[model samples]
Target chain A: MREKTTEPLVRIRGVHKSFGSLEVLKGIDLDVDQGEVCVLLGRSGSGKSTLLRCINHLEGLNDGEIHVGGERIGYERRRDHLLPMTSRQAARQRQNIGMVFQRFNLFAHRTVLENVMEAPIYVAKRPRKEVKREALELLERVGLADKPAAYPAMLSGGQQQRVAIARALAMHPALMLFDEPTSALDPELVGEVLTVIQDLARSGMTMIVVTHEISFAREVADTAVFMDGGLVVEKGPPSEILSDPSDPRTRTFLSRVLKETA
Target chain B: MASATADPIGESSLPIRKRPKLVQWALIAVLGLVVAAGAFSVVNNENFGWPIVFEYFTSPRILSGLVRTLHLTALSMAIGIVLGVILALMHMSRNRFVQSIAWAYIWFFRGTPVFVQLLFWGSISALYPKLILGLPFGGPAWLEMSANDLITPYIAAVLGLGLNEAAYMAEIVRAGIKSVDRGQSEAATALGMPDGLTTRRVVLPQAMRVIIPPTGNQLIGMLKTSSLVAVLAYPELLYSAQLIYAVNYQTIPLLITASLWYLLITSVLSVGQYYLERHFGRSEARSSLEAR
Candidate 1:
């Protein structure tokens, strides 16, 4: 039986992040349940990507707490005071969370198979034989089994992104964050990458994706969030958020995007 | 007009070829004549003592000195590369103190001439007569030795060339590390690899594409710069050649012999550099090709 817990897998309370004088994320609060796919829709500079980065502690928060898997991200409570965690501690926390980038960011020096196998063999300290077997399986699942020996530069943008997804899955992360996985892909190539992600969602993996794909979000996300100016303007099922947004800003942004896509 | 143009195009289509350049051939002919004249003047001049050059070119003493030059180049380059990598990392460190220390080292070493550094290393005993190994600020000493005994001529040469080369190498390595995309390391960090592992697995390999060409230049530069140690009477290639000319009074010939050897070594090193560039350039080739 699935364990029923009152606490969600990811919790964010009043998270704020800034770069110098410019505040990107201002007083954001959200939660994601286990095995749920949360799609964040936002225009550029709306803090969607920053919010995703904060979940994995890739960006430290200015003022707030993010708890992933019940542990405070980038901080520890010591004697009723929150203290910043050391790099080692932060790294350990990140091990349970996998992240994919907009650009493929596959290691140029490594072959596709080696890229998938690297973190498990080095960071997680898994046996090479076992990691290799799982890496090939992940590649096959992503429809890239034949291209394992090829370097990332030799692959299409779509293929490289698929390999990147496989690489993240090899870590067996409890949660995955995708920062515009198909944003950099050609329009024709975007579907293949989205299909791979859809398969992952169906497999009951917890994921938080920052993307502009309204149709994909409608089909895939359990919860759809519309964000603007560093705040969530509306949150509901994808059907409601995409079809009839309560907020005027959400309506305008969706229409703009849909018109462009159309 | 269409029919007229199409008929000629469909026919043989006039095979294209480069224009024959009467001017270029005349220029080449003149330049070749001038070069031949210069060569004939040099070969025919008795003052050059060409016979003496051929005789000492394979002399045992000069050959041994060549070997020593090779040894010094290999040893100094190894030291420069290892220390350079460390200093580059320290230069890029987050700690203010560590970063400034690396900055100071690169500044001091690069600001002054390497020749002065070599001279100082040669007469190091004059500055510090006794070497002490102990705790800082006048603590108990564990070992002691004479600086003269410790700093041999060979050690001095290695220190002079390697330490100076390291400062330049540090800058080159820093530029190389910076050339890699920020996303590369970010991806590694997101995968939970520590800073050091990310640098090793992701950053450095990509950095090598930018690092190798300049490093090969440094290696070739070091090979020639090592001849500077001959001023200390260390019996390197130039010094040994000077010793032979001093006895026979065939100065010009012996200088020519040494120049020939230097040219040969540099040529070989250039070829090696070409192959190394090709090796690290593998991944870049596809992207560049696609771009074209």
Candidate 2:
């Protein structure tokens, strides 16, 4: 792993997202340093996933701004007015940010190799041969080299999620986002996906993960953020936040999580 | 588990309840009765001679009419499929203007009776006596065709049937497109594939699973619907049979002849539809198994 850098790779400020008067994210402010793994921990409907989606502009934010690698996402300045970027521009910006959905939203029609190679050829405009080579390497790295020709439907849930991670990585994104990647998997399958993610973290890939896997968070994440009722209650080093949290909400959450695992 | 033990010889395990053999026998008996009734009518009727039935089918006039019937069916289906695909694409477009235009086309065609459309087109000569083929404003005429000369009854019938079918096909296509998950589009976007390539490569191929079955139904419907063209005196099989029966006064036999041929063609088409549906079903089944 590379040495930690002082400059942050992503900065989110005053981010508020609402869907029809129901505010899901309220005035969020966070900074993630380059090559750092940040775990966003929250209960269901606590806005952890919503915050990750906002970073990619999958769900538009009503009030606030997101910056990736120092560039503001979603909005562009035109004639002194800041307007949301067109759908195409927003999609282009999303190319720099890779996302692995909770449900393993792999392209069902494509084989694993095709899924990994698709974005590089079409989105990044890389040569087909080059993309194929890189995609094969990624498939090998994810321990799925033998399943390149298999469709997502043929793989187990954990395998499908790994393919999804490889597909996201094939784009060479500067930052990766995982929105509860293992939540949809079978209990036994969750560990396989977590292992792949943990490997990525060890390799120094910058990642923001929203997960209920406290053990994985405590082990792999550098910073742990505890969110409750659409707001961050506590955030600090994993050892401190997971064991010595000052906020009562954080303490309650950790106790509940520990009890369930036990 | 206790309930299963209480009823050790469950209803499913009983020999008498094993299979619905009685229901199967009843269906067979019903089918036999219908076939027997049809056979009896043909055999007992004085005018219904098998020789005459064969003779009429092999007659030159009837054979020519058969050829014409086939021509009309082929032509209409060809035109219908091409126009139908276009309308389907239009209906699925995201642009408001394009979508509205498609909606208007579907509403207008589907709202009107096909019979009326046929008659209107057949009599379009009364309104536009001359067909102009030049620029709207002031360009010289490249060619000119009189409506009466160019707009034959057959041409009018084909146009009416093809255009009307396009509207229905558009709805079928829209349903097919909607069946695909929204994530498919997002995945394509994430890959940086342009909209058109994404539609052609990713979306449309998956949508075909939903599209092909309905399109098969429409093809069968078009085969029967072609009978409507007879009202315009296009000399297709039904109209030709009507002409023969009116003179010979053997209505039942002639009608039986025409129906037999229709059944034969539709049966062939049904087989084709079955095979196509099976082919697409296999791929869908494979994909679903993978998803599991």
Question: Mind giving the per-residue lDDT tens digits that candidate 2 earns over A195-244?
Answer: 99999999999999999999999999999999888888899899999989
* DockQ of predicted candidate 2: 0.36
Q: Write the per-residue lDDT of candidate 1 for residues B111-199, one digit (tens) a residue.
A: 99999999999999999998999987989999999998999889899999999989998999999999999999999999999999998
Cα deviation in Å at residue B208, candidate 1?
0.8
Which residue runs does candidate 2 get wrong by more than 4 Å? A1-7, B1-34, B44-46, B56-95, B130-145, B148-155, B240-252, B287-292
RMSD of each: 2.2, 4.6
Clashing pairs in 1: none
The superposed Cα distance between candidate 1 and the true structure at residue A182, in angstroms, equals 0.9
Q: State every prediction's TM-score relative to the real structure.
A: 0.96, 0.85
Scanning candidate 1 chain B in windows of ten residues, the lowest lDDT window is B4-13
